[model samples]
Target chain A: MNQTKFSSWIFDSFKVSPEGLGLYRIFCGLFLLFFLLPSAGIYPFISSLPHTFFQPPPGPMALFDGFPSHSVLLLLHTMLILSICSMTLGWNTKKSSILTGVLLLAIKGFVYSVGKINHDFLIIIVPVLMAFSGWGEVYSVDAFLKRNMQKVEGWVLTLLALFIGFMFFTAGFSKLIGGWLNVESQAALGHVFKQYYVVERQDFLAGFVVNINSPFFWECVDYLTVIFEVGFLLAIFHPRSTRIFLCFALLFHFSLMMVLNISFLPNFLAYAAFLNWTWVDHFIKQKAANTEVKSVKHKWLAPVVIALALVGGWAIIHLIGNDAVLQADWGLAGFIVISGSLPIAIYHLFDQLKRWILERLK
Target chain B: MKKNTVKKIFIFFLIFLPLQYAAVGIIGLEKSEPWPAFILPAFQNVDATPEDVLVKEPVLSIVDSTGVIADAVPSGKLFMGIHESQIQGFFRAHFRDSTRWKGKNAEARSWLANRVNQLYPTADPQSVNVRWINRYYDLSSARRRIDSTRVINEFSISLRDESN
Candidate 1:
């Protein structure tokens, strides 16, 4: 590509207004508060394990003694909820986003210390990377108070696409190395079997998927999985086709949820950043023009709302309990987290329909 | 500092992080850390029934100087009402990947020794062995059979001075 094409690839291809960033901030914040936060409930149980079981990773993770005591883990959970609330409300967004990421990373650090690491790195790192994206510049409590607001740079979204693309690339690389391309082996079918037989994750369509004894169908799935993952990096070079790629990813996550009972719902928040939220920013800006920042008079509004969010998060966490957390599969399944995510999915569907109708009329 | 430099850093980072992660993991099989979800294996298994899938269960032994089982480690009981396989992950992470964090490895081994003695009180355990009990899960039958058991690695327990 020429210099101009390369420059446009990083800057022009991924343009997001401040309000778009704010909308994404709201989505991410609420998603973590309502859907993602409850998954952390399992930390108390994992933390309570005998100290002998603690396995810290190499590098910075080695600095820790192990998973903290149950009390400390609960403290981390509380701080996480608060920061998530602050971040969602767009109050001190950068700091709150950073804090939210660090807290979640720390808690999840302990969670992964047990040996198995789930694909939750995307959700954990999004807030940290995006804290620099000026997401809190508009539609936030800080913006209302006229804090240090700035235009949300388009470059950040481009960078995020790169990060997310590389994540998927690694998955494909790992699978290729692990023998997913072998004709004799169907990784997807084998995974379905593993989930069913060993882990016993027979939820949703898992029962039906487990019964399909066709080698051709399973092999096709294996190839498609690798292609979709590996193709993501190459596809992102244009960024115009990102929405199409993201649609495929949505289908991929949904299939995993339906067939294997594995949910990557949290990734939707990360994917939201890549979407063109310019329409949302325009709509919200139009609304804001008529309606003054009325809540500015009510100094307690942010705190009251955050406190209520905290209460809601607390209630959700308790409702999760041991069995619920297990059923939620640490919020990586369609149970607890999906309850919080379904509304957003429904909204997106309606929005897409509206856009299609509008385009037809035009 | 500059916007151009920052962009270069981000670009460089994206390339470096995944390549290094995949390289380390591919080279070091069991010893590698899958932290922060850098690598996604996605089951990478052959299409086989549950029985055909061979799974390894990590087992621990608390033995005396005579190589006799003085008391059971009861690793399963550590986390109440949790799956044994879930608990086995702890053992796998500690022993299989010990080479990465030697200090923590020794610390965990010694702690395991103390735990054994604490439970039995009179076991006088000298060392601990965290080994893999290989088994197969028959997919059609949904049943598991122990194929074999072998000692993977052993660590000497830092026995506390009883007089102290």
Candidate 2:
């Protein structure tokens, strides 16, 4: 695409109103509150809570047991629960989001070092991003009090998109490290399948996965995950592409939920926060009367926006490279990447295929 | 000011109040119990032989602030049993202020030593070895010495049969 066209698209995508931004904040706050309910007392009541619910995983315990007490663990859980609750209620949501993100990161980091990291750990990154996005605008008590409210524009939205995209891209790039490409190391693919199927006891989905057990499948899964993750950077710049990618992500999560019983619901909810609040703002319009869109023509703004996006994208990929750590289970990571990225890829592919068929018929 | 924000905040506080209350309630209920107690059966009967008879005199030890070890009367019996609750009570009362041995493991051994002394006042105290096998945590961090909320500690008491 030409720079002019790219800039215009970027400008249009970021032109979300304060009300729309507020809705996004509210949605994110509510999402965190709801997701955290499981880890609260409600989790023990749930039969499906993972076995590691009551205590830290053995690996984490071995590493963190040296701490003065389990007070830190208890404190982290307590702070997270409080932050989510406060954010949901829109009571000091900004403060809550920041605290929630920090506490969540600390706990997740400590836990990850201990040997078991849940897919939900990535959800913490969303709140960290949202905290800066001025998400406390509408559904929050601050919005009610008419205090510290500010209008958010295209730049904020673009930044959010970039942040989300970077998360995927970094995860993908990390997998490519340590010569995951070599034929000999490609045997690790079989190990991946065995680890997921036998060790993890996820045999229910083993049939679908095992069928694609060839070296070709392994290499494809490896490279595809990296490409799709990094490809998300491109999608974020293209709003239309993002809509397609979002659908793909949903489908990916759905498949993981169905096949492996592992769904990154938090990350999905976080992505939802970055959406242009046109629909929700419209729905909530009757409750308050400021839902009209004001269109403004700024032809020069487009190119600037596009330039910013490109710079942002490069910065994101560079940052990802600096911190990228190769994971032991790149195959599993590949599977996750496929689950997240394939939805967009498949949708786009289907659209292209349909267009080709129509053209042939014509 | 948006009316929706007011409504949302009110609803949030409504939920928060009840959860905070419930958490406090649970923690309060847990604190009411002075200590947790458990009972394990001894390998043999205490009344089988006169040589295995346990003298009722309890030996008092002031050196260890936790409890006094009672000497046991040498009986030819294979095993002896004591009430877990009674042992736990002695440790809780004696070591209520000691800092060094405050956890579940410490409490369990202290209780067992006292119980052993209570059972046999005349027997060699060294013959009775109190080994703590399993540990349980209450609200306290039983594993850590600092700011631990551990409640009940358990221990196993074995009498080495010198006659054997």
DockQ (C-alpha based) per candidate is 0.26, 0.01
Model 2: how far is A226 from its true place, Å?
3.0
Please give the range of 10 consecutive residues that has the lowest summed lDDT in model 1 chain A: A297-306
lDDT score, candidate 1, position B127? 61
Interface RMSD of each: 5.1, 25.0
The lDDT, on a scale of 0 to 1, for candidate 1 is 0.65
Report the C-alpha displacement of residue A119, candidate 1, in angstroms.
2.8
Summing lDDT over every window of 10 consecutive residues in candidate 2 chain A, give the lowest-scoring window: A41-50
For model 2, residues A1-362, the per-residue Cα lDDT tens digits are: 66556445545666666556665555555545533323332121211222222223232233433222345456667778888767755677667877877777655544332122344544665666556556666656777788865445454455556555655654444454434445433422343333342224243354455344345555665555556666876798776677666666666555544344344445656556545465545544432343354232322232233234434544553456521132112223323433544555576658866877999999
* lDDT for predicted candidate 2 compared with the true structure: 0.44
Give the poorly placed runs of model 2, Cα more than 4 Å off. Answer: A1-12, A36-72, A113-121, A177-192, A211-218, A254-261, A283-362, B1-164
